[model samples]
Target: MPEQTPERTGQPVPEPTSNQVPRLVVTWLVVTVPLAYGLFQTIKSVVPLFTG
Candidate 1:
């Protein structure tokens, strides 16, 4: 038998489960927070160079 695709099966594409939300949020924060901090620190350091 051929494997059924969701289209053929007439099923909707599955959404991310509620259980995944927190994990995704944590993962996003983990990546973005450090990036944000680095960006902020870079801007802070660079501003002093321009202002002085």
Candidate 2:
């Protein structure tokens, strides 16, 4: 077997490659967009409490 590199030594790994870029982006957007929207809506709803 090939020797383990620094990535396998409990360190931060390298960045993904071109083939993985789109998938990573889609995954992040799918997960983050709704979460960010929810957070925004929560903040929007709570703003009135502080202002009024």
Lowest-scoring 10 consecutive residues by lDDT in candidate 2? 7-16
Q: What would you estimate as the lDDT of candidate 1? A: 0.92
Each model's TM-score, in the order given? 0.60, 0.63
Per-residue lDDT over 1-52 for candidate 1, one digit per residue giving the tens place of the 0 to 100 score: 9789777799997776997999999999999999999999999989978889
lDDT of each: 0.92, 0.90
Which ranges of candidate 2 are over 4 A from the true structure?
Answer: 1-16
lDDT of 2 by residue, 1-52 (tens): 7678866777877765887989989999999999999999999999999999
TM-score between candidate 1 and the true structure:
0.60
Clash pairs detected, candidate 1: none
Candidate 2 lDDT (Cα, 0 to 1): 0.90
